[model samples]
Target: MREVAFIKQNKEKWLEFEQAIFGNLKKNPDDLASLYIHLVNDLSYAQTYYPKSKTVVYLNHLASQTYQKIYKTKREDTNKLIYFFKTEVPLLVYQYRRYVLYAFLIFGILTAIGVISARNDDTFVRLILGDSYVNMSLENIKDGNPVAVYKSGSNWGSFVGITFNNLRVGALSYFFGIFLGFGTFYILIINCIKIGTFQYLFYKENVFWESVRGIWIHGSMEIFAMVIEAAAGFALGASILFPNTFSRLNSFKIGFKNTFKIFLSTMPFTLMAGFLEGFITRYSIDMPHFLSVFIILSTLSAISYYYLIYPFKVHKKINLKNT
Candidate 1:
């Protein structure tokens, strides 16, 4: 379409947006998000087809202001944070549910590979888990305390260190999506393989049940958070690789914005895992079998409901909202 025609088409909508911005704000945030998405689409087309025209410049400025209004700006209050997790995040999780499934699928497949490889070769575990780790586990097994490794560090130190490290790994996985998501996949593969081989080693030592009761007291949340991080990364990479109707930059903007929230969603779970591993896992074997099972199942159920089931409910409610 001609530049004049384009300007004529969107000029009134832009004027309305200008009015909304300068006047009292009344639109629902979700409604504003829809407007921002359409505005971005228009801005992207203008940049592509009429880069030298005033229309392009005008749209660019308008889009920038709208983005600031919709995403970057918010009323200052505690409810803002609550609304973020309670509403904004769950909806995005529902929107990108496929990426979460893809991440889980990749982790599952590679985990199977790790188990198969380790079972087929004695050296495979050592190769993947490193000689030191394998030897330490063997020594621990010989000492009749196969899960003593969690006892190495002070509980508080371990709590702080583990939480920081988990967040770092999660953040790295999310950021690596900048490399077209391949980097994130590599991290996910490495992590899944580590879990597989390590567990298989416990199995080989005839401590499979004991290992499960000890490890999964914390591993449920820890491993699940890592998988969610991989989902965030994959979501980012998918956005870049398949911008669909939006321009590459605009798609990326949406991807990063939403996935960053998804990444944030993993934080409380990561901290919970860290706390359990530090304060609880060291004594897991000493606890009653029923208690161990209870803890593990409870953690799994919480994560499953939050990341999987709850998002659907939140999405449904948001759709039914009058706005």
Candidate 2:
């Protein structure tokens, strides 16, 4: 069907939905849910046939509002926290998967820049990482304990400090989305550059594997969570930049609520990373290669599955049920 005809056919129903949604018309919970299902069907159709049209964007916005309304109307007697992780966060992640891709792509580019700059400019590493840290790392390398920095603090102290610091970084990466995401991008760039340079330093000292075994024991989850937090920030910014059918303020409110949930989802992974860093990373030098590799790969795999693979599964399940 032509876009105009499609809109002509459904516009009245949509307007009625708008009335029902905003409380201009009375709607029972089941009635609103049925209407929401119809709206979703329309949304799916628009996505398929008029993907680039304003009609599609409008339908998406309407569908989101309806979904929220349905949830509000029918409060399930379930654990809110468990439902958040199991259903809500996964759906949000799937909805904003593109932003996550963009964040990772940006991270890759910035990291490459760091690697190339560190390789070409002799002073670049020290400039980015600081001279004192560089000197200390070099001495540690000489002492054949290349990642000995992990051993500096007691386990509990390091765990608390590292967790707090990581949480702080994640929060900044999220809240900085208020600046149209540039602030979040800056945060990501700084961290990825430092990471690239730090890794390159290890490669330079012929202890690349040593660095990986020590750092990635926790770095796997830590770094991945940071990228995801950045993705949430991007979503928040996009909400402001393109409000679709919503007022800019309303768009921002929805975006902040959804994206903030996504940010919160990363907390457990970050905490686990901190635990591994404080307790296990300090023993990396004497740890067996296979064990270290397993820990690193396991943490990376767990996080990767949650953010990348599991969201699709949940999305599919929901779609199937709705269909």
Residue 233, candidate 2: alpha-carbon lDDT? 97
Q: Score candidate 1 by TM-score against the native.
A: 0.79
TM-score of each: 0.79, 0.93
CA error at residue 38 for candidate 2, angstroms: 1.9
lDDT of 2 by residue, 1-323 (tens): 99999999998899888788753699998999989888998899999999999998788767766776777668689688887888778888988999999999999999999999999999999999999999999999999999999999799999999999999999999999989999899999899999999999999999999999999999999999999999999999998998876689878887898899999999999999999999999999999999999999999999999999999998788668777
Write candidate 1's Cα lDDT for 108-176 as tens digits: 999988899899999999999899998998998899878999998999999999899998999989899
Error of 1 at 245 (Å): 1.8
The lDDT for every candidate, in the order shown, is: 0.85, 0.91
In TM-score terms, which candidate is top?
A: 2
Model 2, which residues run further than 4 Å from truth?
15-26, 51-54, 68-77
lDDT of 2: 0.91
